[model samples]
Target: MCRLAMKTASKPFSPFSVLEAMEAMQEGYDGSGLGLLLRGLEFAEYKYNAKDPILSGIAHSEAALARLNKIMIEAGFELKYDHEFDVKRQMIEAKDRFKYILRVYKQSATWASLSAEEVENRLMLTRLALRKDGEAHGQDLTVFSLWPDVAMIKEVGWPLGVGQALGLDSGRITSRICMAQGRQNTNYGINLYACHPFFIQGVATMTNGENTAFIPIKDWLSGRGFPGYIGYQSDSEVFAHILHYVTKQLKLPLETYKHVITPLKNEELAAHPQGDFLRGLRDACRRLIIDGPNAVIGTLPDETSMLVMDAKKMRPATVGGKPGEWAIASEMCGVDAMIPDRDRSKDFQPMREHTVIIPPDRQELQIWSQFDHLPIHQAA
Candidate 1:
């Protein structure tokens, strides 16, 4: 599907209506909410314009929070503080729910008000609990037999088709091909395929991001010898290209295999050979290609399908058949960090780059909630 045009400041942003304002009040960080807060803070005479207004707006903020809580409660929430509930707690809750308004308003207002360094510094300070990580996924990976006989691949004209198939821009799709492969960010998804079908002897390391066809070659395959495409770093391009045909285009059955695994000392190596290892590696990729999409059902989907639950079907947060209200943390990651014995990230792989976060629902009201609760102590 074509992506919606992202709102930019160069063109006039349409003025938001009352309905938009009400929705922003509910969501906390919508365009209207940002507009309201931007006009409020940008025109403020207060020294710490950001914080002071929240205290000034607290009465309205409290009313908003009360309504949200009441909805949650009527929806069947058993509200109580886990530790102790202070009035400050409500302010913090509302502030957090709508923190993005502050961010969007900042952007809409301008960097002219802030130093370059201050802008950079503000990112970390503002979103304390946001989890920063990176993830990768793919669609319709297919493979073919290249074990004994080498397979030949043909480069088809500009893979705009591939881009559409995988939900990416045609321009981005075009840049990847026939260019120096670079990283959009280490966090981006990449795609690579064969320029020409040639001999396949060893592992293929394909890449896509800054470029369409560069792969990183490590000396791990020393004995494999200098093979085809002497200019490329890794053979992943060849491999992934082959996979595109075998798994996606042809839907061929592939013999999945692993190329290498450690712990193959005299003891472990005694049971397995080099060929067995490669097969294991291939099988692993195949399984992931098959299962990854299903796993992201609740997290992300290629297509957005709003499962509008019947108003009566959805219930408030519950436990043991009791209505239990939930406290969403500073961010989704924070909530994830709260599960029992959940030192979830301690041993987990740190992302090579920061992860991106997008919310499913409009959150402007949540941001407005924060403005309502900005603390007097934080007042400048």
Candidate 2:
């Protein structure tokens, strides 16, 4: 019922380690689903070349792949390269097997000068089009994410099988950041989209607990006029979107996300010197407030990994590792599984009052607290 994310140095390491960590925490989650998100992929053949859009998801059949490609071509995107992942290792049975795997598309010469925002818009629309077409034609098309340097793999089964199907080995697959979730089936049906490590644009997130404030949060986000906000397959997906909304759209610093979603009470805010700013932030983004025992693990656009918990600290989270490498998980055992030789004495969990931030390729952890004398944005 929880989610875990591992952010390492820029160097690529096999996702096998992530799978191992997930396995160590298997008792905490059901075998319903396993979701993987990889950044700084080491699979040279499918390695990201530029800001080109890399689309990851499932296709029902070869015909569905054709339809997806046609939709992209008609929209003016040219296929610079297409590489389907080797699913020879897919050992588990499921309602649907993935066909027509990962594809990376380059912008056509005509649209070569397009801005990153334009490319993102095109990617979102193309995904939406594919989903719509899938519905109309009875095809199953699920797009996990479309962005640079990131790819997602998800399946409805145990972590071991999902990892095997991915053919993950130190030699075969590697990434700087890999997030995997072993589903426990708390709120929704076992659907592909409901899997953890939900992603949008370049940001990704996975959660270990429920967001009791899901309904209002969903309503508030859906009204934002962004087509990408339409789907809420997993209630926890809102954490990812909220990260996107606050950091991307609201033009706020990353630490502000912790403040908006789990703001302190008025009395607690009064303890800070910049209480006025904190109060204004709470009032402005009140609709985005999240309630209950939730722990969120996510990556920012800059590739920094974040860990935060709600005020109640209902779920377990441990942060540990040496410099240039760090991991945040729902349990200390998961961290121990990944870095068994690390100093366990130094291992620490973020108190409900602090948010943990790990920068890419570095281990200078920053702790942002609500009771700090500085404003929330300046707390980090």
Candidate 3:
């Protein structure tokens, strides 16, 4: 009935490996679809030093491919690598198969002086533009993510079988952070764009429960005057965009995102020295507040991975690891599959109102409390 996700500290493990972990917890998900996003990729060595955007998606037809090529060229993007998924090697085939394209773009000289934030924004707009173009032209194009050091693969199938079908070299194809979601169709039809592990710019998020506050949140975000905020295939996609809006757009600290999405009670806020400051933020972004019973796992642009629960903590999540590696998931089985050697007693779960932030270095875990006035307590 929910989704699952996991990430490592620094090691570049295979995305297929992540898929396997999700497969272990498959009982909770119906496997209507599978979505994978990888950052700090190991297979594409050139991408580490490459300064351009790497975009991947499913192109529904040959005309869609031609149109995409035209759009990219018109936008002053020169292709570095253009590839098609090798469907011949896959284990299963759908009644309607989409041609998967992964292209790395070398931006024109005009983009040389763009700031890091601007460059990221450009990639996002480019990807969203492509999706919109595809839709307008009657093409089923779904761009997963467009950025350097990233690649995404998603399809409608079983998790384990989809993993096997990729036919990637397990040793070579890896990333520092990879997310997989075994989707259970609840609201939307079986659209590939509706799959979870949604990514925008560098922020990626997957949720394990339905987001009851999605419509108001979506409406608020769409009104923010940003072109990239138009799509809403999955209600959970708003979480990913909110991460971008909070950290990149508003120039707010990452912790503030937790508060914006799930603000504390006025009574709890009154006890803190920064109570008024927090209250102003809640009032300004009231529509963004989430109604939970949702467990969220996400990765930020700076490589920080996070695990958060809504006020009720209706969905389960566990964070555990040894010294150099830590991971979070909606189930203990997921964490166990990622780092089985770690001491089980050390596993910690965030309570109903806490955000557990794990940095890339994996040196320590930082728990941010919405209820800052009270002492912190881990879920037992």
Candidate 4:
């Protein structure tokens, strides 16, 4: 079992809050690892450098750090601000991994002349190159995310312990939205890249159950001709890539994500108001459909957050809160831990036919069902 906790608010909040929610449901996870993805940053430096992409990752040695800086400079990326967190001895699962880097960089001059999509592609390519160089040369560097106003951290340890080790509670690292996971080692050995809260471009996601359909899903995504989809360290990583594929590549509406990943059955589709459209979608994207017991919590580039389940709905999940603050978690107790003052009566537990969505505004909650003609909205 694993636990997921996601929180979004009208203003910046501490990442520790998300971890606290996950810790409240620790019984479900084994404490094998903890992963976090933060968006809409509120750090003091962020106010001045919000447009600069932050390269966040781990470096094993001073040589590795120097090599990374050299590469970025040669590539024309100018470093504007840098912050490093020296990992506590107790949090070091690998002796070589010593610190985390949150370095902000201004793109090369060429970026000024390129289209928005071209600029994004350039950033992704640079990150991929850095990751490949590290692996090939044994530099022991791992870059998790390189996007503006976003940061990611992953380590092999208990939730609160890892958070404390990284000094996340010091009130310096905060965001308007945070997605975190307390991982349970199940199908694979403990690997940092395999941790949850997987991110690509600006899309981020974490999962709580095994993806029996991982192989097919990975294959389909790898064949999409996107270089960023190459890393499949964690089977659940496909969830985030799929989300990016549907929303960004395919240009589909966010609500259609639930339909593509957990499509309605043929019989159920026949009765849906959008049956004809969903039928074509299901058939066209059949390879992306997920199986087994899984619950996914994710955030998009626009700051929207969502929680969805597999067709089986075998995993526990819920969404609840008040205006300007909302949370989606794998357990109701997790929600209670995050927002105790919330209206408990309005708490929603999504089933096989439902998806819970919180828009970027943070002013309302939406529950979209496959069986309904439209989503049901609940005002804050």
Candidate 5:
């Protein structure tokens, strides 16, 4: 009964309450340019004022462009107020505006002198785009990735002076923002239907005392369920590359893996199943390698088998995939990305893999999922 109560206590007041809170907080900090807190808040208000979602979203988006200009001034970038972002119809239709913005940042937007405010904007944008885990979620179900780099800030002249915010990549940052904002104005990381955003299991990261590295796993994190332990393999980059290559040797796409590993539609998965075998599960992934689908087939223990069985059904372009929940970081010294692949593929040649499908609206979900599982104190 105490265990049941514990679970009940963990439930949210209402499904949308988390989103409301997130949006409210976001709206409360409206600033332009590097002050993403400010811009996000204003953007939230713009959405709240709308009568129609489609139009409201557009309104908020237009305001973002306007805010981009304001941010330029606030950051003291080379933009001038008499500026113009010559968004061509064809270019807009293609939905690739980052290059265009960078090409004309100074000429197409507002200009000003750098200030603490610009530094502030740069930092905010950088943090939003660089973090390893998702920050926004809905009822802690649909977790998604936020930054893979920093196009949104770069396009607008990288408001955050801190190296373009989130590790120096234009496309990565834009993808992060686009994912978080989605099609609606304020999804704000709430899991509505126990779907993708509510849960996922892939590469994640954590720092070690001496170095940083990746922990690979056929992770089953989310509203979904699978049997296994959380394991550590190597440093982050090496782990990422191997899993990618193994998925290629097999025919599974990443989405298919997500669906199976952290499924929503699969009736086969039973939530909160009986078991206290977590410690054993966690220890299983210590340095496991994938040699190829055929060779890797029977090598794993039951936990590994379960993870691989599901992952194999819907895999990505990877050669070495561990079975568990783990994250990877670049600084893990005991690891190198390429050799793991070499070992995994030495026995066999890699074959083509399926493609993964990524939608634009899953960012808020990813951010939310990252913290939902934490203890209240950890969350804070």
Candidate 6:
């Protein structure tokens, strides 16, 4: 099993707060690896450069770094600001392999002339091309994300130790939302690309539990002819892709995501008001149905955060906090560590049939059930 924690607030706070919550649940996960995704960045420079895309990754050598620069330049991207972590050798494992990088880039001169859809497609394609070139030459270059106001850091080591090495403990890397995972290596080897909080376009997700239906879902996603869906380093990566496909590609509402991935049974659908529409969706997205004992936490491009559970609800998770602040975690201990003063009486543990949603405004939490009525016109 693995541990997951998320922190969201109306204003930006240090990423260290989320790491501290993960530390509280250390017993649930081994110190194999740590992955973090920070969105709604509050860096001083980002205030003025919010439109630029920020590239986050790790380069194994100087040659790999040079190659990345060359690729970005060739793709019509201009470097704006570069921020590389001063990784502490003594604090982290595998000192030789952790050259962390975060750089901002301005799009090409013609970027302003493209449609919204065209710009999104270009960003994803460029990131995929960079990943392919790096892998082909064994450059040990990994690109985690290329989006505005988002930064992802992943490394192998204890949660806090890795956070310290990445300079997260300094309380400077702040964001309005942060999702992190303390990975417990179970099936796969420790590969940095296989870390949690997988990202594509603007959709990001991190999950706990093995996805038994990974291959089928991955195949369906790749066949859709999208370049960003190529990497399948982790079974859970498909969760993010599935989200991107449903919301971005298909242009569906956020609630439709839960319907696609964990559809209601025929019997359960019969009880819903939009049974006919749901039945049709179930048939159309059959291959995307996930089968496994998993709990997922993710954020949408608009900053909406969600916590979802599989039909069986085998994994543990909780959501708690007061107004203007909230936290979701794999265990209650993690929540307590983040906001001890929260109203314990109002804490919620979503059942197998529920999806807990917190909109970008951070005002209230909405719990939508699989049996809830969805307007057919919204999906139409």
CA lDDT of every candidate: 0.20, 0.77, 0.77, 0.85, 0.20, 0.86
Off by over 4 Å in 1: 1-227, 233-263, 271-380
Candidate 6, residues 60-179, lDDT tens digits: the string is 878888898899998889988777565687887775564678888898887899997899899888888778877987847888888888899888888888888778877656889999
Across residues 1-380, which tens digit of lDDT does each residue of candidate 3 receive? 66586877576777777777787798888877788887776554444444557888877777787888898899999987665444544475564445677677787678889987677778878888888887887656667778887778888788778777656434546778887788735688877778888887778888888888989999999999988787787888899888888887877777778888888788988876677778887898888988877888888766788888887888999999876688787788998888888898989999876888888787778887875542212111
Give the lDDT of residue 318 in candidate 5.
23
Winning model by lDDT: 6
Q: For residues 1-380, write the lDDT of model 4, one tens digit per residue.
A: 88889999988899998898888998888888888898988675445467789998988788888888898998899988777663477665657775688888888986798988988898899899888878877748888888888888888889998888878878877889988988734677777788888988898888888888999999999998899998888889999999999888978777888888988888998887778878888899999999869999989988999988887778889999999999988899999999999999999988888878899998889888877763312100
Top of the candidates by TM-score: 6
For all predictions, the C-alpha RMSD in Å is 27.6, 2.3, 3.8, 3.2, 21.6, 1.6
What are the runs in model 4 whose C-alpha is more than 4 Å off?
374-380
**Candidate 5, run of 10 with poorest lDDT:** 1-10
RMSD of 6: 1.6
How many pairs of residues in model 6 come into backbone collision?
0
TM-score of candidate 5 relative to the true fold: 0.21
List the candidates' TM-scores in order.
0.17, 0.93, 0.92, 0.95, 0.21, 0.96
The C-alpha local distance difference test score for the whole of candidate 1 amounts to: 0.20
RMSD of 1: 27.6
What is the C-alpha lDDT profile of model 5 across 1-380, one tens digit per residue? 00000000111121121122223223222211121100011121122211111000011134344544454345444431121123333412223233223211221123135463343344334223212111222111111221111112111111222122323222211111110111111212312111111111222111111112122333321112321121122222232223332233233333222222222222222231311122222233233332222111100100111112222332212222122111111111101121122233322112222221112221111111210122222112
Question: Where is model 5 more than 4 Å wrong at Cα?
Answer: 1-64, 75-100, 103-122, 125-312, 316-380
Better of 1 and 3 by lDDT: 3
> Per-residue lDDT of 1-380 in model 2, one digit per residue for the tens?
56575746656678878888888888887777788888876555655674777778888777777788888888777776666556654375664664736777775666668887787787777777777787677747777777777888888778877777656653565778888778735576667778888887777888888888999999999998988887787789899999988877877777788889988888888876777888888998999999868888888656798888888888888988878777778888888877777788887788877888888756667787767654334433
